[model samples]
Target: MVSKHVKRNYRIVRYVLYKETLLNTREHVWSFLGAFCGIGLLATCQGVWQDERLTVLLIGSFGASSVLVFGAIQSPYAQPRNLIGGHVLSAVIGVACQQLLGADTWYAAAFAVALAIIGMQYSKTVHPPGGATALIAVIGGPQIVAMGWWYVLMPVLVGALVLLVVALVFNNLTADRAYPTSGRFTRIIRRRQQGGRGE
Candidate 1:
């Protein structure tokens, strides 16, 4: 009685709608607050110390990092090690590429991004935002180039650590939410659960 194509389309629509309803109000609130506080702190510090005309505190890649660190809290890429290692390594590679190949060149930008990806992958800290970090170093104008190696410490490392701390606080506020879904934190969570059950 029903057409196969119609049934297939209805199934696809239902699947899409189901996925959309997955994130509830509490998850949304936590994600928003976490990102806001993390980025806000970085921006406030940058504004206080750096010249108003220059964008020093927050890098473009960090925006992408916030999305994963806050929104997709469960993703492996959002883990603390990945977040820090990826950005730091990428920044180092990017600065090296810029210094060796000259900034503002397409070849340097491409090579930096490519090498960053390889480094992240081999290092087992594959965060997607690291690509942007590498590219920014290649063409972030004079200010970023000026910072050079210090860029790895300030914007990349500091920003990531702030986000990780925010995520730890915010995500753990709800009993159902867990941050740093692996490593030491995961073991601690398991111990707590076992202890609660008197195991």
Candidate 2:
């Protein structure tokens, strides 16, 4: 006759342990390498352009992007559509908010992030870093604000593409890891394989 409280405590402990499961050494190494290469490329670009008086290719949001694409590749938010679509949508919304309401107003910043989230949700691209991209557009210093719409094309869109390219390469390097856990890309890949087999 076990006590009910003891049984409940045991269940809770089991659940906690399950949730805290750790990845193997290989996963960690791959994640590290992927993130290092992804950001390293952007950083290199930034270094090369630092003295050019032009907008650099790096942004803070891409760091968060790396966490998802490299460390949590299986996350829906980390998939190709979310990674690219989310950042691009958020950048557009953020820039619009800044231009229409002016970054000086407090509500403008809030609106930028809020609307960006809505946009991502409706578009089915809910990458978390997108929120940061929106906020950066609002609160960013003169250099960012001055870039105006160009900001989206350079650091936001271009930077995301760079990271995406890296994720595509590194995430698929090993047999265990595959990018875009599921999506149109996966479907296309399956179709191609089926076609090859039939041929």
Candidate 3:
């Protein structure tokens, strides 16, 4: 049996913590707007950089991935290194999986996405689009498989590099944000704790 006082206290606490603690700084505002601009750039590029070799939809989705990269929305999954390497690694892995398992249908696709997800988590570069990038390798069929590991070097790696360059420019132009915010700090701390004993 819950008392009215208890319920009221809960409500007041929630309001104070969740609602009253909101912050809306200028940096936050610019990061939000800058992400939209990055989205637009990627969308426009889809029309320009596309080839009919693959379907129209996949090309366009590169644009969406661009948003994830440049958005600077403070997601672990969207940082530049993750944005690039996660997808490239997953794409390469997916293609290899397709070849090994034979890309006939559901199982291979499932394997691709699951492996990609797990791989990203392990690597700590869990970009959301990496799942799609891996699936793209499977569904893209012979053309992708034919790239012979170079597929990642092309659209996956190259595309992410371009997106990162763009993100660097746009995300910095506003003067309120920066990225790759020192995963190295953790590394340094760990090394210090290990006391120079690593082989």
Candidate 3's TM-score: 0.66
Record all residue pairs in model 3 with backbone atoms less than 3 Å apart, i.e. clashing. none
For residues 108-191, what per-residue lDDT tens digits would candidate 2 score against the true structure? 899999999999999999999999999999898888898889888989998999999999888876667778797776566566
Number of the top-ranking candidate, with lDDT as the measure: 2
Higher-lDDT candidate among 1 and 3?
A: 1
lDDT of each: 0.86, 0.90, 0.68
* Residue-level lDDT tens digits of model 1 in 59-154: 999889999988998999999889999998999999999999999689999999999999999999999999999999889988888888777777
What would you estimate as the lDDT of candidate 3? 0.68
Error of model 2, residue 197, in angstroms: 16
What is the Å distance of residue 131 in model 3 from its true position? 1.5
Backbone Cα, N, C clashes tallied per candidate: 0, 0, 0
Instruction: Give the per-residue lDDT digits (tens) of candidate 3, residues 1-199.
Output: 4698899999999999999777768755565565665555545565676674321223334656766655544667767778877888788878887888777778888999899999988888888788888887777767666665666776677667766766666655543455554567335545554665565
* Native-to-model Cα distance after best TM-score fit, residue 123 in candidate 1, in Å: 0.4
lDDT of 1: 0.86
State TM-scores per candidate.
Answer: 0.88, 0.86, 0.66
